[model samples]
Target: MNGTLYVGVTSDLVRRVAEHREGVVEGFTKDHELKRLVYFEAHDEIGAAIQREKSLKRWSRAWKVELIQKFNPFWDDLFDQICG
Candidate 1:
Protein backbone atom coordinates (compact mmCIF):
# COMPACT_ATOMS: atom_id res chain seq x y z
CA MET A 1 0.00 0.00 0.00
CA ASN A 2 2.34 2.67 -1.26
CA GLY A 3 -0.59 5.00 -2.01
CA THR A 4 -0.18 4.43 -5.73
CA LEU A 5 -3.39 4.08 -7.71
CA TYR A 6 -3.99 2.09 -10.90
CA VAL A 7 -7.25 1.30 -12.58
CA GLY A 8 -8.19 -1.18 -15.31
CA VAL A 9 -10.73 -3.71 -16.43
CA THR A 10 -10.26 -7.42 -15.78
CA SER A 11 -12.48 -10.38 -16.69
CA ASP A 12 -11.03 -12.48 -13.87
CA LEU A 13 -10.57 -10.55 -10.63
CA VAL A 14 -8.88 -13.35 -8.69
CA ARG A 15 -6.33 -14.17 -11.36
CA ARG A 16 -5.64 -10.54 -12.12
CA VAL A 17 -5.14 -9.64 -8.45
CA ALA A 18 -2.95 -12.70 -8.01
CA GLU A 19 -0.79 -11.52 -10.85
CA HIS A 20 -0.43 -8.14 -9.22
CA ARG A 21 0.35 -9.65 -5.83
CA GLU A 22 2.92 -12.02 -7.30
CA GLY A 23 4.48 -9.36 -9.52
CA VAL A 24 3.75 -11.74 -12.38
CA VAL A 25 3.01 -8.92 -14.81
CA GLU A 26 5.65 -6.33 -15.52
CA GLY A 27 3.86 -2.99 -15.64
CA PHE A 28 2.37 -0.15 -13.59
CA THR A 29 1.07 -2.23 -10.68
CA LYS A 30 4.34 -4.09 -10.33
CA ASP A 31 6.36 -0.92 -10.63
CA HIS A 32 4.21 0.83 -8.04
CA GLU A 33 3.82 -2.28 -5.85
CA LEU A 34 0.08 -1.78 -5.58
CA LYS A 35 -0.89 -5.12 -4.04
CA ARG A 36 -3.86 -4.33 -1.83
CA LEU A 37 -7.20 -4.64 -3.57
CA VAL A 38 -8.97 -1.85 -1.70
CA TYR A 39 -11.88 -1.50 -4.04
CA PHE A 40 -13.64 -3.17 -6.96
CA GLU A 41 -17.04 -3.65 -8.59
CA ALA A 42 -18.58 -6.23 -10.89
CA HIS A 43 -20.48 -5.46 -14.07
CA ASP A 44 -22.81 -7.89 -15.74
CA GLU A 45 -21.38 -7.12 -19.19
CA ILE A 46 -17.86 -6.59 -20.46
CA GLY A 47 -18.95 -3.50 -22.37
CA ALA A 48 -20.31 -1.91 -19.24
CA ALA A 49 -17.24 -2.92 -17.27
CA ILE A 50 -14.98 -1.31 -19.85
CA GLN A 51 -17.02 1.83 -19.83
CA ARG A 52 -16.98 1.98 -16.05
CA GLU A 53 -13.23 1.42 -15.98
CA LYS A 54 -12.77 4.31 -18.35
CA SER A 55 -14.94 6.50 -16.20
CA LEU A 56 -13.10 5.57 -13.00
CA LYS A 57 -9.76 6.26 -14.64
CA ARG A 58 -10.89 9.77 -15.45
CA TRP A 59 -12.13 10.51 -11.94
CA SER A 60 -10.07 12.80 -9.71
CA ARG A 61 -7.82 11.18 -7.12
CA ALA A 62 -9.90 12.62 -4.32
CA TRP A 63 -13.03 11.18 -5.85
CA LYS A 64 -11.44 7.81 -6.30
CA VAL A 65 -10.19 7.70 -2.71
CA GLU A 66 -13.57 8.74 -1.46
CA LEU A 67 -15.22 5.97 -3.43
CA ILE A 68 -12.79 3.42 -2.11
CA GLN A 69 -13.22 4.58 1.47
CA LYS A 70 -16.97 4.36 1.14
CA PHE A 71 -16.74 0.84 -0.18
CA ASN A 72 -14.05 -0.17 2.31
CA PRO A 73 -13.92 2.06 5.37
CA PHE A 74 -10.67 0.58 6.68
CA TRP A 75 -9.22 0.09 3.21
CA ASP A 76 -8.94 -3.63 3.89
CA ASP A 77 -7.55 -5.95 1.26
CA LEU A 78 -10.47 -7.81 -0.26
CA PHE A 79 -8.53 -10.51 -2.05
CA ASP A 80 -9.35 -13.27 0.44
CA GLN A 81 -12.98 -12.18 0.59
CA ILE A 82 -13.29 -12.81 -3.12
CA CYS A 83 -11.17 -15.96 -3.08
CA GLY A 84 -13.20 -17.61 -0.34
Candidate 2:
Protein backbone atom coordinates (compact mmCIF):
# COMPACT_ATOMS: atom_id res chain seq x y z
CA MET A 1 0.00 0.00 0.00
CA ASN A 2 1.42 3.31 -1.10
CA GLY A 3 0.44 6.93 -0.35
CA THR A 4 -1.37 6.17 2.89
CA LEU A 5 -0.13 8.25 5.82
CA TYR A 6 -0.29 8.02 9.60
CA VAL A 7 1.28 9.89 12.47
CA GLY A 8 1.73 9.36 16.19
CA VAL A 9 4.24 8.79 18.95
CA THR A 10 5.05 5.57 20.76
CA SER A 11 7.54 4.50 23.40
CA ASP A 12 7.77 1.08 21.76
CA LEU A 13 7.90 1.81 18.08
CA VAL A 14 8.29 -1.79 16.98
CA ARG A 15 5.39 -3.08 19.00
CA ARG A 16 3.16 -0.22 17.95
CA VAL A 17 3.93 -0.66 14.29
CA ALA A 18 3.37 -4.37 14.54
CA GLU A 19 0.03 -3.81 16.17
CA HIS A 20 -0.99 -1.56 13.32
CA ARG A 21 0.30 -3.90 10.68
CA GLU A 22 -1.39 -6.93 12.14
CA GLY A 23 -4.57 -5.18 13.23
CA VAL A 24 -4.04 -6.49 16.75
CA VAL A 25 -5.28 -3.19 18.13
CA GLU A 26 -8.01 -1.90 15.91
CA GLY A 27 -8.30 1.79 15.05
CA PHE A 28 -7.69 4.22 12.24
CA THR A 29 -4.47 2.66 11.04
CA LYS A 30 -5.91 -0.82 10.84
CA ASP A 31 -9.04 0.39 9.12
CA HIS A 32 -7.13 2.40 6.53
CA GLU A 33 -4.02 0.25 5.98
CA LEU A 34 -1.74 3.02 7.18
CA LYS A 35 1.23 0.79 7.88
CA ARG A 36 4.02 2.51 6.06
CA LEU A 37 6.64 3.72 8.48
CA VAL A 38 7.80 6.69 6.45
CA TYR A 39 9.43 8.79 9.09
CA PHE A 40 10.35 8.86 12.75
CA GLU A 41 12.62 10.55 15.24
CA ALA A 42 14.23 9.48 18.48
CA HIS A 43 13.74 11.42 21.68
CA ASP A 44 15.59 10.94 24.92
CA GLU A 45 12.58 12.16 26.87
CA ILE A 46 8.96 11.12 26.59
CA GLY A 47 7.77 14.67 27.31
CA ALA A 48 9.80 16.03 24.43
CA ALA A 49 8.51 13.32 22.11
CA ILE A 50 4.96 13.99 23.14
CA GLN A 51 5.43 17.69 22.55
CA ARG A 52 6.91 17.00 19.15
CA GLU A 53 4.04 14.70 18.27
CA LYS A 54 1.58 17.42 19.23
CA SER A 55 3.46 19.96 17.16
CA LEU A 56 3.53 17.59 14.19
CA LYS A 57 -0.13 16.87 14.49
CA ARG A 58 -0.78 20.58 14.07
CA TRP A 59 1.33 20.81 10.93
CA SER A 60 -0.33 21.24 7.56
CA ARG A 61 -0.45 18.19 5.33
CA ALA A 62 1.88 19.79 2.85
CA TRP A 63 4.44 20.51 5.56
CA LYS A 64 4.25 16.96 6.79
CA VAL A 65 4.59 15.55 3.28
CA GLU A 66 7.62 17.73 2.68
CA LEU A 67 9.16 16.45 5.89
CA ILE A 68 8.63 12.84 4.90
CA GLN A 69 10.10 13.52 1.50
CA LYS A 70 13.14 15.09 3.09
CA PHE A 71 13.86 12.05 5.23
CA ASN A 72 12.35 9.35 3.06
CA PRO A 73 12.02 10.50 -0.53
CA PHE A 74 11.30 6.96 -1.70
CA TRP A 75 8.52 6.33 0.80
CA ASP A 76 9.97 2.87 1.40
CA ASP A 77 8.64 0.78 4.24
CA LEU A 78 11.04 1.48 7.09
CA PHE A 79 9.83 -1.05 9.62
CA ASP A 80 12.60 -3.57 9.08
CA GLN A 81 15.36 -0.99 9.16
CA ILE A 82 13.93 0.62 12.23
CA CYS A 83 12.41 -2.27 14.15
CA GLY A 84 14.80 -5.02 13.14
Candidate 3:
Protein backbone atom coordinates (compact mmCIF):
# COMPACT_ATOMS: atom_id res chain seq x y z
CA MET A 1 0.00 0.00 0.00
CA ASN A 2 2.90 2.35 0.63
CA GLY A 3 4.89 1.24 -2.43
CA THR A 4 4.49 0.78 -6.14
CA LEU A 5 2.61 -2.23 -7.56
CA TYR A 6 2.87 -3.57 -11.09
CA VAL A 7 0.18 -5.17 -13.22
CA GLY A 8 1.59 -7.62 -15.74
CA VAL A 9 0.63 -10.63 -17.85
CA THR A 10 2.35 -13.99 -18.17
CA SER A 11 1.55 -17.56 -19.12
CA ASP A 12 2.87 -18.90 -15.87
CA LEU A 13 1.55 -17.02 -12.90
CA VAL A 14 3.73 -18.74 -10.34
CA ARG A 15 6.92 -18.19 -12.28
CA ARG A 16 6.12 -14.58 -13.01
CA VAL A 17 5.25 -13.87 -9.41
CA ALA A 18 8.46 -15.57 -8.29
CA GLU A 19 10.47 -13.42 -10.64
CA HIS A 20 8.95 -10.26 -9.23
CA ARG A 21 9.44 -11.33 -5.64
CA GLU A 22 13.05 -12.34 -6.29
CA GLY A 23 13.88 -9.22 -8.30
CA VAL A 24 14.61 -11.34 -11.38
CA VAL A 25 13.01 -8.82 -13.72
CA GLU A 26 13.95 -5.18 -14.01
CA GLY A 27 12.02 -1.91 -14.56
CA PHE A 28 9.20 -0.46 -12.48
CA THR A 29 8.71 -3.57 -10.40
CA LYS A 30 12.35 -3.99 -9.51
CA ASP A 31 13.13 -0.29 -9.25
CA HIS A 32 10.11 0.78 -7.22
CA GLU A 33 10.07 -2.19 -4.81
CA LEU A 34 6.77 -3.36 -6.28
CA LYS A 35 6.63 -6.93 -5.07
CA ARG A 36 3.45 -7.00 -2.99
CA LEU A 37 1.25 -8.30 -5.87
CA VAL A 38 -1.82 -7.39 -3.86
CA TYR A 39 -4.16 -8.09 -6.75
CA PHE A 40 -4.30 -10.09 -9.96
CA GLU A 41 -6.71 -11.75 -12.39
CA ALA A 42 -6.29 -14.91 -14.39
CA HIS A 43 -7.28 -15.23 -18.01
CA ASP A 44 -7.18 -18.14 -20.41
CA GLU A 45 -5.94 -15.98 -23.24
CA ILE A 46 -2.62 -14.18 -22.94
CA GLY A 47 -3.91 -11.37 -25.10
CA ALA A 48 -6.89 -10.81 -22.84
CA ALA A 49 -4.74 -10.83 -19.75
CA ILE A 50 -2.29 -8.41 -21.33
CA GLN A 51 -5.16 -6.18 -22.28
CA ARG A 52 -6.45 -6.21 -18.74
CA GLU A 53 -3.00 -5.49 -17.41
CA LYS A 54 -2.72 -2.54 -19.76
CA SER A 55 -6.08 -1.19 -18.71
CA LEU A 56 -5.20 -1.53 -15.06
CA LYS A 57 -1.78 0.00 -15.62
CA ARG A 58 -3.37 3.07 -17.18
CA TRP A 59 -5.61 3.60 -14.17
CA SER A 60 -4.74 6.16 -11.51
CA ARG A 61 -3.19 4.89 -8.29
CA ALA A 62 -6.36 5.59 -6.36
CA TRP A 63 -8.40 3.57 -8.81
CA LYS A 64 -6.01 0.67 -8.53
CA VAL A 65 -6.23 0.77 -4.72
CA GLU A 66 -9.99 0.77 -4.89
CA LEU A 67 -9.90 -2.16 -7.29
CA ILE A 68 -7.64 -4.11 -4.98
CA GLN A 69 -9.80 -3.40 -1.98
CA LYS A 70 -12.77 -4.91 -3.75
CA PHE A 71 -11.20 -8.29 -3.04
CA ASN A 72 -8.54 -7.61 -0.45
CA PRO A 73 -9.89 -5.01 1.92
CA PHE A 74 -6.70 -4.70 3.97
CA TRP A 75 -4.40 -4.77 0.95
CA ASP A 76 -2.54 -7.78 2.23
CA ASP A 77 0.55 -8.96 0.37
CA LEU A 78 -1.01 -11.47 -2.02
CA PHE A 79 2.31 -13.07 -2.84
CA ASP A 80 2.02 -14.93 0.45
CA GLN A 81 -1.51 -15.93 -0.38
CA ILE A 82 -0.44 -17.20 -3.77
CA CYS A 83 2.43 -19.19 -2.33
CA GLY A 84 0.18 -20.94 0.11
TM-score of 3: 0.83
lDDT of each: 0.92, 0.85, 0.80
1 versus 2: better TM-score goes to:
1
TM-scores of the candidates in the order shown: 0.95, 0.91, 0.83
Q: Give the runs in model 3 whose Cα sits over 4 Å from its true position.
A: none
- Model 1: colliding residue pairs: none
Instruction: Report the Cα lDDT for candidate 2.
Output: 0.85
What lDDT tens digits, residue by residue, belong to model 3 across residues 20-64? 778988877888766677788888888888888889989999998
Candidate 2 residue lDDT tens string, 1-80: 23566778999999998888888887889888776688999999999999999999899888999999999998888999
Find the 10 residues in a row with the least total lDDT in model 1: 1-10
Quick one: ranking by TM-score, best first?
A: 1, 2, 3
Worst ten in a row by lDDT for model 2:
1-10
Q: How much RMSD separates candidate 2 from the native structure?
A: 1.7
Q: Pick the candidate with the highest lDDT.
A: 1
Clashing residue pairs, candidate 2?
none
Error of 2 at 63 (Å): 0.3
